[model samples]
Target: MTSHNPHGHALASHTLPGHDHHAAERARSVADHAAAVVELLRPLREMDRIETLPLSQALGRALVQDVAAPLSLPPFANSQMDGYAVRSGDLSDGGTHLRIMPPVPAGSSPQPLEPGAAAPIMTGAMIPAGADAVVPIEKAVPDHFLDPAKTTANTPASTAGNGNGATVRLPGTAAGTFVRSVGSDIAAGERALAAGTCLGPAQLGLLAALGLAEVTVFKAVTVLLVTTGDEVVEPGQPLPPGKIYDSNGTLLEAAMKQAGLLVRRAGISTDNPAELRALLRTEGQGADLVVTTGGVSKGAYEVVRQAMADQPVDFLHVAMQPGGPQGLGTFDGVPFLGFPGNPVSCLVSFEMFLRPALTELLGAPARRLPLRARLSLGEPGGQLTSPGHKHQVRRGSLQPDGTVRLEGGESSHLMHALAGSNVLVHIPAGVTELADGNEVEVWML
Candidate 1:
C-alpha cells in the first residue's frame, strides 16, 4: 500500500520478502562484488578523443599515434672531435705531411679534399673527400717541410717548421677516432615513440630530437567534487559544538589532483535535499565525473538519498569495511560516485574501486600498488574479526625490511590514523584472525 505524505509525495514500504534470507543471499565476497560493479559500469565508460598538442603542453598526456622519425638524426656524417675532418685512407708510417688546404669550419658546404691532401677542419665539420683520417695537432710535430724554395711568403710558417713550409706528424694518430656516422642515433621513417605511450620528460626530449613540434595525445578527464555533511565546518572557521572541521574535502581534492584529474569543484553541502539536488544537477555540467561524500546511508536526514531518490542510482553495500556503503549512478549524463562520509573511508573507497575503474577507462595504467609484507605484531585471537560480508581495511606502516606494523585504530572516522598511515592493509572477507608474521596485501597510498 502507498500513502501520501504531508507534501503529497507517495511513500511505499517496499520491503524484500524473507529479509533475513535476502540479506544472507545478497552478501558476496569482495572480489565478486568488485567484479560485478566493474561489469555494470563498463558500458557507460568512454575515453576522450585524441588531439594534437604542442610539445610544451603534452606533458602527462597519453600518445594517440606512433611518432615516426621525420628525418635521420645527426643528418650528416660529422666530426665528433675538435681536431680535423678527413677521409679514412691517408694514414702512412711516419705520417705524410701534406700542405694544409683552406680550413672547413662547421655550417660550410661540403668540399672534396684534394687527392693526397688534408684540410684543417674543426669539430662537427662535414668530412671531406680524399683524406681518410684525422691527425690531432697534439700528436703532430709542426716542423717538417718541403725545400725553402717551395715555401710561399703568404704561409705563416709554423714555429716548429724548418723554414721549408713543412710540418712533422706522428704515426698511428690517424686511426678512426671521432666521426659520428649519419643516422647513428635514429633513421628516417623509423618508429621512435610507439602509440599508446605516456609522454614524460624523456619522451618529450626524444620527440624534440626527432624535430616534432607537436604530437597527438588523449584528452584529460575533468572531475567535479561535492562534499556533504551538516556537521562539517570549513577550516579556519571556529568550530561550534557538535561540529568538526571538514577534512574529506581537502583530502579528496588533493588525491584527485595527484591522480592527474582536473578537479573543477570542491565544496561542502549540508543535508538539504533541495540544495543537494540543485548542485548535482547544475554544478556538474561539462564534467566527465562527479564525486560526493556522505548522506547515502539509511539515516533519518540522509539528504543525498532523498535528493537522488527518483534518479537512476544503484545503491549497494560493498564487501569492504570503512567504505561499505556506495552509490553509483548517472546524473545529467555524468557518472557520479557517492562515497562514505568518513575521511579515511572516502580515500580508501576511491583507491579500491573508483580509481582502478577510471584509470582503465581512460587508457591509463591500472593502479597496482600492492605491497607484500610480514605482520610485525601479533593480534589477540578475537581482535581481528570482521563480518563475513566486508573486507576490513587497516592502517599500517611498511618497515624498511618489508615488515608491516599496524598503526592506529581501524575506525573510519579516525583521520589521525589515516594521516600517519603509508599503506592500507586489505583483509579479505571470511578471514577472522591473522597471527603475527602472516603475509598481507597492502595498497601503498
Candidate 2:
C-alpha cells in the first residue's frame, strides 16, 4: 500500500507472503526498490556540507566542486628523453653530423640551438628555445659526450667533425618529436577533475602534478549506527541462552567505513519502544543518516516500528531476499534506514540500496559491484528463488576456478554460513535453477 510521509513523499510497503506462496502482483522489482531508495536520499546529497581537505588527507573523499588546473601540465616544453636536442631542419636531409653544444642536465638552463649545432639534453630537461626535436642518445650514431656536468663546447668530446670529434649523426625527425609540449595533458584553466569525483591515488597524483595542496570536497556523509534486538550481545560478551552477539552493528560500521562514511556507534537498543525512541532523539541530531538493524520485521517485538509509529518512517517488505523487511523514515529530522537483523541481510541491504544511492548522490565512484561467476555446483537445474521477491542473497565463496559456490542455505538467520562465505551470491527473481556452468552475479566482500 502507498502512504504519504510528513513531507508528502510517497512511501510503499508490501505484505510479504510465505516463501511457498509468493504473490508476484504484490512484489516490487529490484530496480524499482532501488529507485525508491535513491529518491529518499536525493535530498540528502544536496544537503551535504562542503569542506576543504588537504591533499594529504583527501584520499577517498568525494569532490563537491569541479577542480580546474591552475597551470598547464608540464608548464613548459621539455625533453621527452635523454638525447641530443636539435633543430629538425638540421637533420631533414638524412643522417648528418652536428657539433654538440653543452650538455643540458635536467635542472640546468641551456642556450637556444644555433644552426648546425646540437645540444645534449636529459629527459625532462627544458628544451632549448631553438630546438624542435630530440634524438635519443642511443639512436644517435658515434659521438659520445662526457656526462652533462663535465661536458661543454670546449671539451674534447664536444667538438665538430665526423667520428672522433664531438659530432653525432642523427636521422631526420619530425618537429616536436620526443618533445613534451606544455599543457599537453591538461590545459591551464581547464577542468582537471569533475565535481563528485572520488579522490583516489591516481586522482590525488593528478592534483599533485598540478601543484594543488588542497581540494574542496563534500564532507563525508556521517552515519549514526544503531542496532536493535535484545537477544543480540556485543562480541566476546557472555552469550547467555537465546542471545547472539550483535553482528549487524559491527558489520555495518565496517562497511560504512569502507564506503568513506563516518560511522558513529550508538550501541544496541533493546526491544523497548520508549528506549529506542529516546535513543533516536539523542543520536539522530547531527547525523546525515541514521541506520538501525532489526525491529522492523513482522515480529511482535518490532521496536523500531513501534517507536517510529508517529514518525515518517515506513516499515516495508521489499521484494528482496535475506533482507525483505526494510525501513525508511526521518528520525529527528535525519534520514533513517532500518535493516534486517540478520548479518547477511543487513550487509546485502546496504550493497543493493545504500551503496548505489550514495555513489550517485555523493559523486563517489562505486566501490562495490557484483562479479559474474558460474555456479560451482553442477546442479541438476537452476537455483530456487522466492516467487514474489525479485532478488535473493545467498552466502557464497568465490572459488579459485573463477566460479562462486554456494556455502550456506538461503535462510537469513544462518550466520555461520554467512561468516564462512567470502561473497554474496545473487539470484535474480523468477529463476527456478541454473545448470552447471551457468554464470551468476555475486558481490565480493
Candidate 3:
C-alpha cells in the first residue's frame, strides 16, 4: 500500500478495492476522513501560555484568568450635579433657609458642614461630612449685595426694616437624592470578567472601570505555508502557455490568518524532488506546521511525494468532490499537511478539516458558516452514487428568502465558482437523487 516519491521517500499508503490502483482510494466518507485527520493531528497541537499584557494590547485577545474588582466603583458618596449640599434634617416641607458656605469643587477634600448649613457643590464633588442630599441651583435664590447709588435713592421705611433681613430659600429634597453611593455599580472583590472570555470593547471598558491596567491572555500560533506544483506561477504575472497562476497559496494563507495563525512563509516549490526535499528541510526548522497544496496524488510529477520520500506521508482520498486528495504526515519533526492543487479543492479541505481541529487546540469556539435552506432548483445529478464513500461538497449560496442556489460548474479547477460561492452544500454519499425542494445542510463561507 506504499508508494515511492522521486526522492526515494516512501509515502504512507491506503488500499483501494480492486479499482484503478493508480488512483488513490476515495475516502469512505468525507466526515469520517476529516475526523480521522483531526485525531491524527491532535497530539501535535499546541497553544501558547498566558502572559500579562497591558490594556492597550489586550484587545481581541482571549482572557486567561478571572478579574475581580479591587475597589468599589465611585469609591465614595459624591455629588451627581452642581447644586447645594445640605443635611437631610434641614430639608423641610416649608423649605429651610441656611446661610451659604464656600463652594466645594470636585477633587478637593470635603469641607465639614455646620450642623444646619448648606454648601454649594459641583458635579462629582465629594459630599460634606454632614450633608446627605443635594438641591440643584434652580431651586435656590441668589443673594443681592448692597449698591450705594441704588440703595441711597430707595431708602424707605419698609426697606430699612427688611434690608438686613435678606435670606436665601432652599427646596425640599429627600435624603440620598443625587448621591452616587460607594459600590453602587460594582463592589470590591466582585468578579468583573470571567476566565477564558474573549475581551471585547464593553469588557475592556469594564476592566478599565475596575482599575485594571493589564490582563493575561493566550498567545496566537504561528504557521508556515508551502504550495507545490511545476505549473503554478505567482499572481501578477502573465499566464504563459502550460502554466496557471498560484491561487492556493494566497487562499490558504488568508484562511490561516483568519484562524489566528501567524503565517511565517508562503513559498512555492516546482515539481523537482531535490529542490522540494531541500526546501522542506530548511523550512521545517521553526514551523509548528507545514502546509502544502498539490502534488500529493499518484501523478508522475507529484513533487511533494517525490521530495519527502524518507518522511511519513499519508495519501488520503477522502470521499468529497473538489477536495478528495490529501496528504498528512510529519517532516523533520514538524507536522505536514498537503491538499489538492485545484484552488477550490484547497479551500474546501481547509473548511472541512483544519479549521475545526485548530479551533479545539486553541480553545476557541467551533465557528462555522452554515445555513439551512430549500434547493432553488432540482439537481438531478447531485447525489454521489458511489457504493463505499458518503459525503460531497458543492458550492452554493442563499437566496434572499433562504433558498439555496447551486453555483458554478462542479470542476475542481474553477476558482471563479469557489470565489462566487458563499456556502458549501454537504450532500451525503449513496443518495441517488435529491428533489428540488429538499432541505439540505449548508456550510457558510
Query: Best candidate, lDDT-wise?
Result: 2
Quantify how close model 3 is to the true structure by its C-alpha RMSD in Å.
8.8
Cα lDDT tens digits, model 3, 281-350, are 7876777778888887777778888777888878777766667778888887677888888888888888
Full ranking by TM-score: 2, 1, 3
Candidate 1: give its CA RMSD in angstroms. 9.1
TM-score of each: 0.69, 0.86, 0.66
Candidate 1 residue runs with Cα over 4 Å from true position: 1-49, 72-187, 364-393, 396-406, 423-444
The pairs that clash in candidate 3 are 6-306, 9-309, 9-310, 10-309, 27-317, 369-444
lDDT of 3: 0.72
Highest TM-score scorer: 2
| Number of backbone clashes in candidate 3 | 6
TM-score of 1: 0.69
lDDT of 1 by residue, 268-300 (tens): 888898898888767787887788888877668
Residue pairs with clashing backbones, model 1: 87-131, 87-132, 87-133, 88-132, 89-132, 144-166, 144-167, 144-168, 145-166
lDDT (0 to 1) per candidate: 0.70, 0.79, 0.72
